[model samples]
Structures are given as structure tokens and as C-alpha cells.
Target: MASCIQIEGLLQSYIDEEASVSERLLIEEHLKSCGACSERLALNRATAATLFEVWREDQLREDLTRRVMAHLPEMPPPTSVSAALRRQVVVEGQRTRRWLGAAARLMPVFTPVILIILAGLLWVAWPSYYNMGGDEVIGMVTYCDANPDATHYSQGQARRLHVRNPIMPDDHFETGEEERLMLSLAGPSHITLLGQAAVQVRAPRAIVVTRGDVFFDVFRDNRRFQVHTPDGTITALGTSFQVSASKAGTVVTVVKGEVLVDNETSFVRLHENAQTAFTATERPTVRQGIDTSPYLRTARAVRPDPDAERRFLTQFIRNATHTPAPTEQVFVVNTERRHVNALLLKWMPDPYTSGHAGYTVYVSDSAMAPVFKTTISPEIFQDKQNNMVRLEMPNDMRRHDTHVLHITVMSDQSSGPVETTFTEVAAIGEAS
Candidate 1:
């Protein structure tokens, strides 16, 4: 590695906006990892601000910066000069020569220029996803059910992400706590990203999961698909896996195929239904027979919630706690593995027949009106096998839309009348 002194001239050129693109890149990358260099840049900025204060009111920063920096008094071009010296002279001759000499002296070479250039070459040759900097479109957001929590930062703009947003090598992608995003890599494979995560596309096939969890569904054809994290690098092919990363460490779980993890000090290979984790300074510890279903079961297709989420969470909590619950939902929208001819609703209260009378069923594909309505008798509901009621979905409904079903459980109580509405949603072709 080149020392700080070796690249000092390159750094000065960067500040002056006189460096080549490659040189500026080298210094910028260096500044990211070197605190001393970063501090030097800060101090340089402070000095420049002070210098600007002394300039005339009419002098622009650019004008002052471009002003001749040579301290020597100007001298006239001479008719007689050695051929070697004359090489530095242009048509303007000695005046240009003196300026050239002064500029060279002002920007003295602290170290050999060749050495700084060699460092630049090494940086270019270094193996990293960021080395390939470009605006070339690498992928696109295939599915983004984004709320305000989701953002896609590209070039210099940050905005809400949407389907069809082109991804560049340097683009930054982040999601809010409950957001979900998907990226199609212009190939057969794609990436399903969970929320509260930050990601940067290093290459078309490589990504850096800076924080939070991410799922990769990669194809074997995209041979070198890899993910980088604070702790290590994970490489896989023809695999489905999840990576949870933080500054503390990383955890990798393999769903179907194998993955290789390197934590700087060592490497570990994890196969199907296996997992491994490690810190920055420790070797990965592998665990076998791990259940990967939880990671793979993330819901990618989401339908809009119609305020029934309160009931959903209530039911979810009751189920999680092993509380005694009814055999059937008050109302439900079920998923059938294939297209169905009939819409089924199973309603079973804790007691087989708790209602004082019958309940009204209302089904609709829109709020404007119910497509079907009927009074379901509690006696018939209980006597029937499974208390299952079937409704014919509207044939005119959109192929991709879902039907909403809600029922008001009516009972004549001491208060004269009592009613509780149980709501459910059903998708046309979803699996049970």
C-alpha cells in the first residue's frame, strides 16, 4: 500500500479540481478509510475559507484559485535559450516557461509521480464491486409496494422507489421498517429485500448489505453472485439464501443450495437447511438442520388491507399464545391452491350456536354495493358439516382483484340489539 505522502500531490490536485478522473477517485476512496487524510481535507477546507476572506469583494473563488500561483516576478522571453530549455516554451516562449516552472514548483512532487500512479493502477486492479463505477443500468425494481419508508437513491437524487426504477451500480436502496422491495437483475434470478435494510449494487451480480436482512434468489447462470457485509463476503450460485447483517456481525442461512462465507480470517461452506454466523474477528460457526422456512416465507404479494388488520393481529396474537380459539373464523378470506369455482366461508363460534338468531352476510368486490347478501340461520349453520357457506364470485370481476367478505353477527341482547362485524378477504387464485 502507498503511504499518505505518496498520494499527497494527487490529493492537492483533487482539491484544486485539476486531477484526472482516476486520480480523484483514488483520493476519494482513500479518504473514506483514512481518518488522517479526512482530517487533512477538513483542515485544508478551513485554510481555503480563511484565504478567501482576504480576497477582493469582486474576486470569485474560481478566479482566485486559477490566478497564477508563481511567486517569481515575470521576466521577458529571451531569444537565446538551450534546446532542452526551449522545449518547455510554446509560441509565448519564456513567459510561459517561467509560469510552467513556477506552477511546477508550487505543486512540488512530495513523492515520485510514478509511485502515485502505481497506487492508482493498483486501486483499479483491486477486486471490489465498487471498482466498476458507472451509470449503466444493471437492474430494475420489479416489485415495490413502497410506502414513505422506501427510497431509491441514484446519481444525486433520492426519491420514492417505484416499479421500473432503473438501478445503477452506485445506486443506494433502503426500506422502512415494514417495507418490501424486489429487484430483477435483467436475468432469470432476482432479489427480494426486506425492510429496515440498506443496500448498494456493487455490480450486476454483487451487492453490499450494509445493514438489516436481505434474501437472494439467484440463478446459476449468474455465476459470481456475491453479497458483501461488514463482517465478510458471501458467494453463491443457483441458491436461495438470507443474510442478516449489522456492524456487530452477520448470519447466513441457506434454503436450497450451497453458499461459501469468508469472514476475513477463514471460510465456511453451508449447504441446504444449514446456517452459519460469525463476527469480524471470529471464524464462522455452522449449524445444521436449521429451519429456513421462516426466511423464505416472507410474503412478496400483498393486497391492500381494508382496516381488518386489527382483527388479523388479534387472531394472530390469540393463535401465538395457545389460547382457546374457535375452530373457524367469524369471517375469512382463504387462499386456494388453484382457481376455485366457489367461495367458501366457515363460521364457527366457540359454542356451536351462540347467536340469538341469524346473521346477515354481505359480500362485495367494491364498497358501492354487495354482490350477494343473505340471512344465514344459526341452526342450519351449526347443523351443516363444518358450517361452511359457499358464495359464487361475480363473473364480471377483474381477474387480478380480490373479493372482500364481511358478516355482521347479529344477536338480540339485553341492550336490545348487539352486532359484531367479522371481515375477511379472499384472492382468486392463491394457494391454501
Candidate 2:
């Protein structure tokens, strides 16, 4: 015979049908004599049954609501409430009763027809609603180590890949020891993956680095390219950069061009030959002259065509300097001490410009009084293809102040000086 406390412990298991046969028999025998235990078991069963009944009723109500909504006809707005009230008391009441009775009689027949119509509508609209298109092959594996074990995830399934495998968006890659992989992507971007690295192609313009080191030789384009690390996100401004991740922090190295490194609290811009480090809980630290010789060697070996760079630059310039400059372009000036306050100015040359001489940037106070000026050399824009220049604020003038920049571009074919004025506002806040 089982004691009441023992039977109490086994009661739930017995009710759930998980008790051993001997234990079940023992509990059954005890329940026959123990009123309290028997009542508890009965109460538990009754509660469960009531809950199931309520759930079933709720589900039925939901189905009926959906069907009723589908069958409802559109109604026009009421006109002349006094007239409507008089009509509703007489002719409308009879019509309403007849319609309700007829609807009740036809519900069974209408259900299947309504379901079929809905299914057809869903079938017709499914693709556009979900945007389920074939995955884009953005890149192909150019190199792999001997029998290197790399896996790619697609459509919620993981598959192993060999050399020459096509990389698609949302395709995650995990490499093993002694493994080296190279990817040639659409932007003429060359990515080199070292061993023990994990990365995902989040989109055509974005890559997420989970661990290890990867080098990027991103060809300059108008697209916003980003690399997300655990510590921060690095945004490319037409640059070749490298991201290295570890348990301690993530390191970003800019070999050429520029990049913006941002964490939750602050952001810092890195130029050529610059580097920065970020940790999840700490502010980003800028470092001087990182050694990128090893990655630079790899980038040079797989360098893209010189013409591609020129085309990208030309397209960017055309887009940035369209006919009749837009009046609403706003450039925010950063007041954070760690960030460089600069404005990027670009312009298109006249139709017959053979060569550009240079540019002169003049900074003036709010009253239009000249405060600072500098002349930029044509060599700065040479081979870049893009007629763009950056006007940086002198260190002394970077304090909380409003300034105006007057830019004049000199080219051989220009009939007159090409000039534009920009307002720079120093907003007070931490850099984002």
C-alpha cells in the first residue's frame, strides 16, 4: 500500500500515463481508499478537460469570424438618418430578417467556395507578398586549401563547398585549420579568408565577421559597403580594409582610402595607413600606422583592372554632381574630439575640360569674413578619376562654431570658375 504523500507525488505521473505499471497499480489502490487523493486527481482531469473545451471553442470562433468577414458585403454610408430610421422600422426590418435567414441556410455551401477563392488569391499573390526569388550568386571561390573543410548555409540547410563554389547572400562560411580561401565578388572585391575564420555574406553590400581575420580589396563604388563585427561596424568609403576578430576585440586596418568605425557609443574615421580597435564595452581606440604589408601583397596579386576603378570613379562623380546641384544637401559637422570634421565636395568638369589645375577651399565665418584658406593640388585628384576633394577644418576652428565653405574648381576647359557654397553646422553630441 502506498502512503498518501507517496501517492501524491506519483499522482501527476499517473494522470500523465507515465508511471510504471506497479506504481500505477499502487496509486490506483490507494486512490480507491483516499478521498483527498482521488478528489485531486479528478479535479486535475476536470480542469484539463475544461481547458481543452475552451480552446476548441476559441478555435471555432476564430474560423467563424474569418468566414463571416470574407462573406460580408460592402455597405454604403447612411443617408438622412430620419428617413433611414423610418425605413428601417418598416421595409428594412423584413429585408434584414430575410437576408439573415438566407445567409444561415447557405453557410455550408458558401464555406468551400470562399475557401477556394481565398486559396486562389493566395496562390496568385504569394510570390510578391513573400518576395521569394532565387538567391543571387555574388561571388565565387577562387582558391581553397587541399581538402579544406568549408560549409555554407542556404535556405536553412548547411552544405559543404569545394573550390569554385558560388557564394550567395546569407551564405555562412566556416573554415578549418591550415585552410585558406579566396573569393572574387561582383564589385571586383577580393576577399581572402584565413584559417579558423567564420564569416557570412549578409547581403551584396554587407559582410558580417564572426571570428578570425579577413582581408578586403573593395573597388570604389556608390554602394554603401559595411563589415559588421561583434564589437562594431566598419563602413567603407571607397577603401581597401582588413578586419580581424578575436575574443578580446576587433581590429580594423585601412590600407587605402577611408573607413568609418562605429560602436554603439561613438564612431571614428580612419584614413589610409590608419588603424583602430574596438571592444564591446569600451570606446574605439585609434592606432597609428598598422602593418598591412602581408594583406597588401595579397591584394596586389588579385588587383582588379585599372579601367574598372576609373569607371566606378566616373560614375560616382556623375551621380554626385548632377545638373544643377540640389539645394537640400545637408552635411553634418562632428564635434567629437576623436572624429575628423571634414566636408566631401565633388563636382563635374565642363564638357571640354582637358585637365584640372587644382581647387581652392575658403572657410569664412557666419558674416562671410574670410578666416582660413587652402589650395589643393591637382595631383591629389590624379588617377582617382573622381573630381572630389575633402575640405577639413583646421584644428583650431573645429570648436562649436558655424562656418561657411566656398569652393572654386579650376580646369583647363572651364569658361569660368566652378564654385559652390556649403554651410557646416557643428552639432553638439557624441559621434555616431
Candidate 3:
């Protein structure tokens, strides 16, 4: 090989500590004869020795630290038991240090994973917390008149108002005036709205406000299934009732079934005839009321008749199912002639049993009654067909002029009566 190539190979072999004894002797002889080769060999050896010395110094320092700590003045004497303990401590500490170093090295890789876990927890725990700037109120409206159908109203007018549905945030009513406003809603039962009251409504609970003046009835559809008033939170399951607040505190009346009232301190069960009132404050005084007789009485007196509802449903179903009049004038009623045509009537399917189908017919002026009578059924009808009585007006009917022709229909099961009225009078020269 060329001189330069030979020198390069020798230098690499020396660096790798791979030269055989004969090879090392040959390299030494070549170096002694060549000044350049000698200088290169010395330089390489010096570099390698400096590197090895640094590594040795680090090992010595670590050993010295361990030995010195083992011999510290504060250390207990090295009895056989103590020596064993010291060795164990040193081994465990070294293992712990290795684990700590591994953890530190992995910190950059794990940082995003830790942050993602934290973010997921926050999202699941409180969804609303993220929407800190969104408006919470579902709707707001002003009512100025007792009239329920007023489409428009002037501001500040003494009007009866309503808020149909609301999200009912804990911080909704901020003002005392807003709290005093009374609202009522009709669920399967009635509900009384409470003004700014601090109450806790628990789950699986229902509430009733027997009576105390407070305004606002949050309809049952509102998100507030439970109510928190000054007295306490009333929790319920599928209940319709009212809650009232006053100097006496808050009273819950159940319009329907039972509800459980649990203040942070105690719990109580309230039934239809029972009510529970809680006073405000941390150490609240709670009172129970019986004889919900007044509440029951009020509910029955004001509640809409369910029978009327049945009738309403039955009437519509009958009109749609039965055949309709073929012509625009298929059924006609002439008050002047005291005649009615195409009148329909229904009786019980079983003649022996008194079942009422209903009466739908074009009535003449004579058929209209000043006093709406409930008892007149088949006897008042003048026409009869196939064991079925046909409803009609009395031919002699007169005193009741400007007659009204009406079609009345009723349901089989106590559905209240529903009627459509039409005036019988015709314009001058108009056909009757």
C-alpha cells in the first residue's frame, strides 16, 4: 500500500484498540523512522488519553459521592442490620432515579396527551361553562291587559303578561321586582311561579303552591322541572301544582300526586292533602300544613271540564266519518216555514240501554231554544225512522224568531256537547 494509505489504516486500528502485538510493533517501528508518522501517533494517543481521563473522573466522582454519603456523620453505625438496610436503600434509590430520568425524557411526548385528557374532563363535567358569553334567557314578553288575546299593548300598562317557556337559569331573576311578578302555567296540573327565591329543587320530586301571592307560572314544558324558592327546593315527578312565597316562607301544594321535599338538612314527603313550608336561611324552620281541602276545592272549581273535552273530540270524529251532504244545500232550514231538512240523530246501539250518539241537523228557527235544555232527548223530536228518532223543530215554533240553526254533536263517553250555530234569517228578496 501507499505510505499515506498505510498510515491511515494504522491510525484507525490504533483508535479501535484492534492492533495485534506484531502489528503494533511494526507501526511503532514505522513511526520512529518517520517524523510525520511519529507526530500523528503522539497526537492521537494524547487525545484518547484525555477522553478516557474525563470518563474516569466522572465515575470516581459518583463513587465518592456514594461513599461519602454512606459515611456521613449523621449516619447510624454500620451494624449488620444497618448495613443491609443501607444497601437496599442505595439500590432502590438508584432504581427510582432511573425511572425519574425516563419520565423526564418522556415529558415532551406526554404533554399533549395530558392536556387532551384535562380538556375532555372539563367538557363532560360542565357543558354550559364553555358558553360563557351566550344569552341564557329563552324569551321575554310583556303583558298589559287581562285579555289573553291582546296582540298589542302600550308599555307600563297594567296588563296580564306571560312568559311561555324559559331555560330557568339559577341566575335568572336578579331583581326584587322581577321576583314579585306572578305567573301561572297549566301542566297536567297547575303550577305557580316563584319570584327571586333561594330554593333547591331535587330530582324525582314534585311541588305544589297551595297559596301565597307570587307571580309567574312557568309552564310545565320549561326546563325547570323542579322549583327553588326562598323556602326550599321542591322536587317532583310528573306533577302539576303551585308554590307560594310570603312572610310565612314558601308553601308547596301538590295539585296531583306526591312530592319529596329535601332541604340540605332534612327531607319530608308531601301528599295531595299535605304541604310543607320552609323559612329562609341556613338554619331554616320548616312547617307542615294539612287540610289541603282548600287547595283541592280551588283546583276543582277552576279546572276546565274534562267532559266537554270528550264531546269536542267525539263531534269532530263523527262529522268526518259519517257521509256528508251531497249538495251545498243538501240540508236546509227555513225559519219562516218552520221546516228543517236532512237532520241526523243517534241513540244507543242497544235500544234497551240509554246510549246517546248525538244530533247533527239543519234546524229551523223554531228549534232554537232560549233556555238551553239538557234533558230534552227523543221526546222533543217529531220525526221517527227505523227505531231511530230524527231531530226536528216543532212546526208551531214561532215566539223564537230570528232563528238560529245549529248542529249539536256529543260523544259516547261523556264528551261534552259541541255545536255550530247559523242564523236562519234571509236577506230581503233572498230565498229562504
Q: Highest lDDT: which candidate?
A: 2
Whose TM-score is greatest here? 2
Q: For candidate 2, what is the TM-score?
A: 0.40
**Candidate 1 residues 1-432, lDDT tens each?**
556876676666677788999887888878888889888887877777778777767585475443565555678886697776677665567788889888788665744676799999999876332343423656656567667333788875785677655567777888778887776553334576788788888676789898887888775443678899989999998677889987778999987778999987999999989999887779999999998756755622322122222222232222334322222224444332233345555532211122223555555433435455555554543342343566554555324243443433343222211122222333344343
1 against 3, candidate with superior TM-score: 1
TM-scores for all candidates?
Answer: 0.39, 0.40, 0.26
The order of the candidates by TM-score, greatest first, is 2, 1, 3
Angstrom error at residue 413, model 1: 62
Candidates ranked by lDDT: 2, 1, 3
Worst 10 residues of 1 by lDDT: 412-421
**C-alpha RMSD for every candidate:** 35.9, 29.0, 28.1
